[model samples]
Each structure stands twice: as structure tokens, then as C-alpha cells.
Target: MVLRYVRRHFKPLLGIKGLWTFRHTPLAMYWAKLALKDMLVETVLKDENLPPDVTNAHWIAHVVSYAGYLAKIRYEGYDTNDDSKTHWVHFCKDLYRIGYCADNHLPIVPPLNVIQQKQEWREWIIKRVTGGYTMHALTQQLIAYDNDTQLRKGTEVEVLDKFSISRMRVGYVKEVIGHRVHVRYWDTDADDQDLSNSFWCHEQSDAINVVGWSKTVGHAISAPAGYDPAEIGNSSVIKKNPGVNIQVGMKLEAVDPLKLSAISAATVVKVLKHGYLMVHIDSAGHALTQTYRGVESDANHGNNRFCYHVTSPLIFPCGFCKENNIELQPPIEFKTDNFDWNEYFKATGAKPLPLKDLEKEVIDHGFTEGAKLEAVDVMEPNLICVATVKRVIGRLLRIGFDGWEDNYDQWADATSCDLFPIGWCQLMNYDLQPPHVENQEPGLKPVSPGVKRIKSKSGTASRSKRQSATSSSD
Candidate 1:
């Protein structure tokens, strides 16, 4: 009703009495953002072709266009209405005029009744709904995002600041410029015509990249896969300290599991015997930003007890995130239940074991590239399959799953319990899952007998030593 009265009386004042000065007001700016966002969204029926990419592009274009107009208005000293708004260059000549309230006395208008307000809102919504969108639904969600965290490349984000067609899509940041983002998102939008299309997005006022207290949800930053992870398991020996062992612990760089980016500043905390360590990051969020003066918001706050192998790529030296220009997020203080890992290890017998002796065993076994073997599928522990050695790199054997794509292939460190010799599955009373080719003959012919001897010898000896060492440490 206030808006209605204002529009009625303010029409005359609006023409030469420009209102764009409200751009400086925080409330007005926020209001404008919502208004602009809502203006681009259309209510459609369930059957409507609401491809996320098209919708995203549409909304992005709207924001850019509006931003451009605002920029023009600020740069040029001109007031514009629907009519009589001359060329954009008019403002370039003069300073923009400012408008302010002159008196405390305001025009009194009849207020809207509660029922009338509801009716008006219902009508407004009905007007926005198209012909097909009136269909009913079972569940409706009204999720509120509290924070609009700054976005950077590698942020794990879901699209919904929702004017775009790609609303609810989950993806990682591929690139970003200013307020615009290039999201490599994935969604099951089968009906969407432009599912594969890349959409440029302008960040929303309430865009949330990370949550402060949601433990069940995913983190705001995504660990990058572009870098090769450290392979300590492939090596028989590693230094006691991180960064120094691989590269120096005090200044070593590592991937922040809470917010994965290129790298973050971290210090070694504790060296777990089984190829892992506890680390403390100075700041997980803004790890990418260069430190010119003061520390960040989350600096030196948590134990950040992430256990990483000596060769894990997640660890890195200071300034790694900044040097790479990767988007960083404040580390989430994940709330987990307290439990003693030592007791759990003793109970389950699943303690992490050192790989040094196992590496020597694999090397001594004479297992080389192109060697064939039978191996257990970690995803399906009950199944064993024919596998081929793709290469011998360091202390790990890169094995390709036979008859299966490389997606299921693996790099098995000598200490990994997953690998086995040919016919070992048959010997264990576990059925083997061979390749489904009718003409397939035995591929690991020589490996079968040799594998039996290696398994009974080095494999058994390594297991005994690993158990004994872990027990002694415990």
C-alpha cells in the first residue's frame, strides 16, 4: 500500500526527480538485487521446457544488462524513466542529481487489510503463473541460504540463486571473474534441451558457498584433481616430517579437505605411524589470498586434524593457493562425535600399516609391467577378477581391470591388501569373476604358479610384520 500510494503521488516527481540515487543505500541495493532476480524467473508448469542452462543464461544476461545500466547511470549524470530517457551518454556531461526527503510529514494513505493483502499477494502470484504451472505437487521446499560467501574457482557449489535454468545443479567452479562464475555443474536434467551448455552466472546477494553449521552437507571448496596426489604407499620409506619428507613440514602445502583448492598453509602436527599425519592450517578460508598485513578470519583456529599420507597431494607449502589463484573457502569446523581411534584400531584390526617392507617384497617378487594377476575388487569385496599390470611405478603396481574400463583400474601399493596372485582367489575358496569372453584362455599362465609362491612367501611375511609393528605401536 505504501508503494501503491508512492507510485500514485510520486509519478510527477519521478521524471526529472531521479531515484537511482538509492544505489548508495544498502537496503535499496539489496531490494534491487531481489527485484532484478525475481523479474527474470517465470512460473512454468511441470511439463514446461525449463532447461537450467537457458534459464541460467537468461538470468545472467539480465543481471549483466542491469549492472551495465546502473554503471551507465552512475557514470553519466542523467535521470531516466521509461519514456524520455535519452541516450546513455547524456550522463557523461553532468554530475548525477541527488534526491532526499525534505520533511517528516508523509502522505497518509488507506492501509491494506490483512485479507486484502493476502488476496493481493495471491493474485500477484497467480498472474505470474503460466497456463501449465498450476499443477499440484506433493512436497515443497523453502530452503533459506544465510550467507553469500565470496566465490572462487574450485568452490563446490550448487546453482540456485534460482533465476537460472540450472537451479539446484551441483558443480565445482571452473573459473571466475569479478562477480561472474563459470560453473562446471552436473545435473540430471534429461528434459533440458541445453544440458551441456555452459552458463555464466552473476553471484546473488545471498549466494552461499559454505555453511557454518551443517555437518551433513558438503563443503564449500572442492579438492582439485588436476595435481597428481602423493603416492607414499608406492615407496618403501618416507621421512618422519611432512613437506620436508616429500618437499618440509613447517612450510609444506597440502589440500584442505574441508575446502580443497590448489593448496593451503599448514604445519605438521603429529606423525601417525601408518603413513599419515595430523596437520594444522593457519587458515583454511582465504588460503588463496596473499597475506599482506593482518591474518584471516579462521587463522590458527582449529586442530584441523586431517590425517594424510606422506605422499598425499593435499599437503603443500605456504602461498600455494595464492600462487595458483584457486578459489578458497574458510574451513568448516566439522562437528564429529568424539571417539578414540586407537581403541577402534585395536577392536577392528583395520589399523593403517607401513608399506616399506611390502614395497621390497613386491620388488623382490619380480612383478613387472604387463604381468597378469587376480585381484579383489574393493567395491565388491566378495568378487575377484582377472587383472593386468599396466605399469610398475615406484612401489605401486598400476593394475588395469581386465575386460573393464580404466575407471575401475587402480594403483596398488605393495602393502595394499587388495592385490593377489593368479589362482589365489581359487585357492581361498572364493569364486573368481573371469572375463566373459568365450575364447578367453588363461592370461596369467606363468603368473599362476609363481604367484602362489610369492603369496605364500613375501605376502605372508609382510602381513606378520605389519601386524606385529602395529601391535607394538598400539
Candidate 2:
């Protein structure tokens, strides 16, 4: 589904946006051209570095001051002990670099937080002064040139008057693709584009409101469990056994009147959602069976308190007998009679143990003691060990593909591995001549019927009598 959506929408939108970038923006294109020229000149010219003079040194000082300002404020996070709070100092310098400040233009460096640890700040300044020119310097140069050409039409730098040298409309400067600027139009009308449209938001908001109302209505109509079951018919299948809490899908056995204790026949009762299996007893008018209940007491039993938890089942061996050991006989039908309510209660009580606490206990002492201490693990440790060994052996059998054989044993006997194909390749002897022999053509030369070549043990071929005589004569 994701692939289908991307193919239909995202790919085409990106392609169109990418194409429009170079066509629309002039400033973006010029900056790109300037950067490339600078790179070429720097590489070819040996002595391209500007000479160190008084004016040049002053300009370098300003650049260093600005960079230090930026490093202290923009990049690093704030520290209470450090006084590097003035971010605007760097802002004015950045503006100055991009034609906003002219020659002899003294910027009013605003007072801000001071960067602490004199030794560290001094080292940072030294590095900036000595480090070779970077791509950032080239970008700054373009900004400085643009500002000088555009901003200084008539204004002069006065040593006496502290006026704003920061002029020239500085729109947000994005570092577009190293130094080049690329602009593209994003059409809101495009089908593939996901613009912040009011239509989608409005529709989604309405859907959420409807869902909230629906959930409220659903809760109101639902019936509670253990409601009176006398309204429903018959109620004959349910039989009361001492201490047993009758539940859904329970089978009962009928007892013979004369025998008193011997059961005669069996029957099952099916329970419905929030419905009870009503049993008609000999003396009692009606008795309720286990039904769904959602009280706090029923929390461990999946919110079904009246119902006995299914984990502990009351097993009736012969189906009609209450005893564990029973013999199948003629005429008598099978039934479930034994009522083991104690097992259900125990299981239900323990069900609410927290997962983390249970896990901790398991880690400390296994399942027999609550970890994975099954009878198999405790009684047959060697079998478990053998199983682990076989798993390792299987992994080793399927190894060898390429340089990525570091996981050799792990990947070797993977179900996916195959040494050879069936019919052509066998375990002992496989006919692996070539593809040409496998599919022989009419016009093609008949492939030589398999030949068993004898390999020489020593690195030399045995010479025949005639071949030896010819070699000696030569």
C-alpha cells in the first residue's frame, strides 16, 4: 500500500520541485558561480593569500571578533556560569559581512554575556586567526560584497557618531546547497502534495466526534451479566454439585432416583453473552449458572466473576462418572460430573500477579520455583544440552557464500542452503558438466561423454617412450 501511494504521488511532486529550483532564483545561481570560481582560483594560484597589511589586519580582527561571537552564542547552549548571552553581536557581524557594513564602518558591538574561561576563548580566537580559509569564508565574502555594493550609496562611517551601519534588507539567509541557492515552487493545488488544507482537517475532526458518540451509545445498550435467566425456557441442563460454580459450556449428569448416587444420563448447556444457564433443581425453583460479571472482584477473571476461570477444568473421565478412574460400559451414556471449583478459585486468585514481579521470581528460581524449570529441564538436562548442540551443528552445515562468512556457523545449516539441485546434482556423485551439456541442441557439437581423467600425484606428467626419444633427440 505504501509503495502504491508513493508511486502515484510523492515521486512526481519531488521531480517537478527539483526542476524548478535552478530556473527561479538569480541570487542562488550567482552565489553558486562565485563559489566554484573561488575554488578553482585557490587551487591553481600558489600565492593567492591576501597580504597582511594594517587595513587587512583590521578586517581580519573584525572577522575573528564576529566568528567568536557566533561560536559563543549561536552554536553552543547557554551556561549560567558563562557570560555568552549576547547573540545579536554575531547577528550584526553576519549582517556586516553580507554588504550591510562598509569600509571604516564601526559596528556598535552591543554589550551581552561574557564567554568565560579566558584560556579557552583565547585558543579559539588563535585557531580562527591561523586556520586556512574555508568555504564559509567564501560565503562570507559574497555576503560582504553584496552589502558593500548595495548599502553604501551615500552613508559614510563617522568615528564620532554611533549610527547604525546595518542596512540593506537582509531576508532570511539559508545556506543553500553548500553555497548555491536553489528555489522551487510548491503548488498547494497539486494532487500529490500534502499541503495544510482546511478540508482534510475539518473532515478528520468530524470523524473523531462521530466515533466518540458511537462509543457512548454502544456502552448504554449492552446488558450486564448474571441477569435473571428464568425468562428463558426449559432450564433443565444445569445441575447443582456441592461447592461448584456452574459456568458456560458445562455438561451435567443425571442421577437415578432408586440408586440415589448413580448418574443416569448427560446433557450440556450453552451460555450466551451476558446470559446465564438456568438450572431447575429438585427442590429449588431455579438456580443461576456462571455468567459474565465486570465487578472489581472479577478483575482477575477477565471481568467475568460469576464464571469459573476456564484454566482449571473439572475433568470427568467416563463423562458420566465423578471418579477419576472409570470403566466404559454398555447402556450408560457419557457425562461430566466432577465439580472442581477450588482449582478455579486458586488459578483466578493468582492471575493478578504483576508481570515484573513474576519475571523477577522466574529469574531467581525457575517455573518449578517460577522460572522455566519444567520437568523436562530438571530431569533431562542432557537432552536439553544435546538439542542445543544439534542446533549449532545445523548452523555450521549451511555456511559459505562470500566474504560475509563471519556468521558461518549461524548461517550454514539455515533451511535455505543448497549445495546442488536435485536430479543433476547428488550427495555422492553429481553430473556437473556445464549448461551447454545440460540442454543439448541439434546443430551443436555432441558433448564428450564423461571422461575420468587420472590426476598425477607429482607435479610432472609421465612421459611415454616415443615422447622421451623425441625430446632427447631434439
Candidate 3:
């Protein structure tokens, strides 16, 4: 029996890679067998006398044939683009071959393609889990940081670069399960409003990554339509960052100390790197920057100095609270009711990069699309993001944070400290951020340059197996 065979050989199947993807393998195989039966019945009817005694060869053939069929129908022809169609087919054949070997304990000789896809799928699944809110709070409080945030419903947010790639966009949280938040961006098209189909990206301190999940048959969400948001302003959350310097103004999502439960819109009022940042909660109607010290944790308990860092989940881009329809705590009633950011940060204020200046920088630096680099995270200034230059505007690079999907990208200035040489992190002895890569090495993260393509609104894109480009300092 299949069950007996599986139990006897369970150790081998467990030892094989991609065992989790096969968590639902039986269900998938069952459906494939249903299709096979139809084909078999048709064949028997045509022959009129073929015996129904099924053999092990028949089972193996069925697995290969069905895998091939799934390859064509399910995975969008498995990367059969242009002249590489034959290569793609052979790759799928090798995948099936490996799957067969993993199950049967046959001498497995995996091809470059099979060895490759297994690596990719493994990494992909890991990213999906870490980038979503499915983990427990204690677990999150422990990882120090990750790809996404612990975003909850009704939280207004301005996700400029944390979980999305853009100048800035205002959105409201519809729901949060584990690590994924179903957000409704008011500026998005009708297609983007649907929560179930949307690919949600999770944010840690400085960077984020996207994980795709189903809206149906899982812990998905459906936010109420026509729900009006209160206390959330409709004005543009785009404010000129006064300083792009070490002691400069950077947009950060800061927790409103007054409103501990809500995600208040805040920014770096003062930057004191190596240990401190003075944050001002603007949209939440708070006054002045609150000083925060990073890296100092209780020696005995391991509790960090600031509950969150500049890249902390507690803080977000300016205007996050309003964008998400969450109310900001109103500033004290009568004393200096009006606040002027431009005047406040006049000396060392932050400003968004101009179109022409950014373009010139891109050309000067040769920061072409798909170029790789080490980037400083604006939120977690101390850490280096193993990144790629996703898009090149005149002088700015639309940056991709991690993994192959292009969803968790951000916009950064060409001359900002945020972008650095590939080996800067190692040279400085700072810990490089964890990768969303498959079989990645510590220092070198090489990726095959995927052709520049438009990123989908839902954050879903073709994840054809890509070989990462390793990094080396000259």
C-alpha cells in the first residue's frame, strides 16, 4: 500500500528537500489521479481489451506526466519565454525526476535546473512565513527584526519604503493575521482594493519582503466596503525630508507614546547615530521629537532601550496613522497650535530628491536597473540591506529590499548614505541583514538579472528561478 511504503521510507522523504511544499502533495496528487483516470478510461475504451492491472511503472509514469501537465497549466509554462522553451521543459522534467527520486529512494542525479528550483522554492516558502504576521508575538519580540511588521487592523499608515516601493502612499489596515496585513490604499486602483488577492509585504525595521497567500481557504480577509475613515486626513503625506545627512531628517514610523496602541505618523526630528534618534510624531498631533537610544538592552533581561528602533516596527513613515484611518493624538490645545516642519528642520531638514539631480546621479554612478549594492536602511541606520538598484530615475534608485519579488521596493537618493558599496557592511563589522535568497552565502548574494518588468499592483510577479550574483570588493 502507498501508506505502508511511505511509512517504511518516511526517513528518506523527510530527508529530501521541499518536504513542506509536499504538505499538500497528497491532495494535489489525488486531483492529478482523477485526471489520469479520465485519460485511462478513454484509452481503455479505444483499445477495448487493455487490462486494468496497474504497475509501479504506471504510477511513476503518471507522476511524471501529471507533473508535466501541471508544469504547463499551473506554473505559466514554467519560464518558457522566447528561445528558452526547451530549456524550461527539460528543467521541469528534471524537477519531476528529482521528486520521483525523493519519493522512491532511487539514485538521484539532479540536473542544474532541478537542484535550482528546489533551492528557490525552499527560500520562497521561508520568506512567506517570516514576512507575514502568522507568528506569535513572543516569537516576533525575539527575532530582533524581520521582513514585515506586526501591523494590526484600523491602523493608518504611510508605507513609503517600509513595505512598498514608492515615493509615498496612504493606506488603512483592513486586517492582520500573523505577519500579513490586508491594507486598502486609497490611491490604488480598483484592482488593488481587493484584500484577498493582494500580495502583502511585511516590514521589519529598515526593510521588508512580500509573501503571497490565498484570500479563500486560509486566514484571509474581506474588509467592509464604503467604510468611512475619521481623524485620518486626506492631504498628501509627502513632506520634504530636510536633511539627508548623518544628523539629518529621515521619515520614520514612530509609536505615539501617548497612544501606545496605534501606529502614529512620525519622523526623525534629530538623528544621533550609533545610539540615538529624536522622533517627532507629526500626524498624531504630537509636539517635538522624543529621544530614543538604540542597542542598549538590559544585560540580564535582553530588553532593548527603545521598544523599537528607527527601523522598528513601532515606527513608520510620516503620515502612516492618517493614511490608515487611525486617529492621531491631538497636540496640547492652546500652546503653539500650529507646527511648521520646514521651519523646524530648516538647518538640517530632509528633502526628497529632485527628478533631474537623481537622474544625473544614476548616470554618474552607473546605478542601472538590476545593479546590486549594499544599502543603509533609513530606519535601522546601523544595518546594511543587501539590495539591488531596482529602478533608476534621473538620480534616484528605486530599490528592491530582498528576494526575487519586486514588491518590497523603496525610493532612495543617489548621494544619501543609505546606498553604499557592496562590501561596506563587512568592512565596518556590522551585521548584514538576513537574506530572502535561496542557498545564499554570507557575503556574496548574486542573482541573475531579471529583465526589467513593471511591478504589479498586487505585488505578485513571475519568480522564474534566478541565479544570484555574488558580491566581491575590488
Instruction: Give one digit per residue, the lDDT tens place, for model 3 in 1-474.
Output: 211222233322111111111211112122322322112100001121112442222111111122211211112112434332221111111223213333555432222343356556445433433432211223222222322345656565533222222122355656543233345554455345332222233332122212211111111112245433332122222112233332334544444433233333344544443223455544422332221121222212211112222323244444444455444432233124443334334634554211111112123544566545555433333334556666664454566755635433545545443554433333333345544545644543433443453322222232222322112110
- Each candidate: how many clashes? 25, 16, 40
The model with the greater TM-score, 1 or 2, is 1
* lDDT at position 18, candidate 3: 19
| Candidate 1: worst-modelled 10 consecutive residues by lDDT | 463-472
Q: Per-prediction RMSD in angstroms?
A: 28.3, 37.2, 22.4
Instruction: Give lDDT tens digits, candidate 1, residues 5-81.
Output: 22233342111111122221112223333323212121111212223323211000011112111211111111223
Q: What is the per-residue lDDT of model 2 for residues 1-474, given as tens digits with 9 covering 90 to 100?
A: 211222233322111111112222112234333322111101110122223221221111221121111211221212334443222222213222222223345432211221333335435544543533323335545434432321121121111000110111111111121111111112122232211110111111111111112122111111123322223223322222333344433333232111111222222232322222221111110122211111112112221111211111211212323242322121222122443323433543312111111111111100011111001011111011001111212112212211111211111111111211111111112121221123433433211234322222321111110111101011
For model 2, state the Cα shift of residue 223 in Å.
83
Residue 189, model 1, lDDT: 32
Worst 10 residues of 2 by lDDT: 365-374
lDDT-based ranking? 3, 1, 2
lDDT of 1: 0.33
TM-score of each model, paired residue for residue: 0.24, 0.15, 0.22
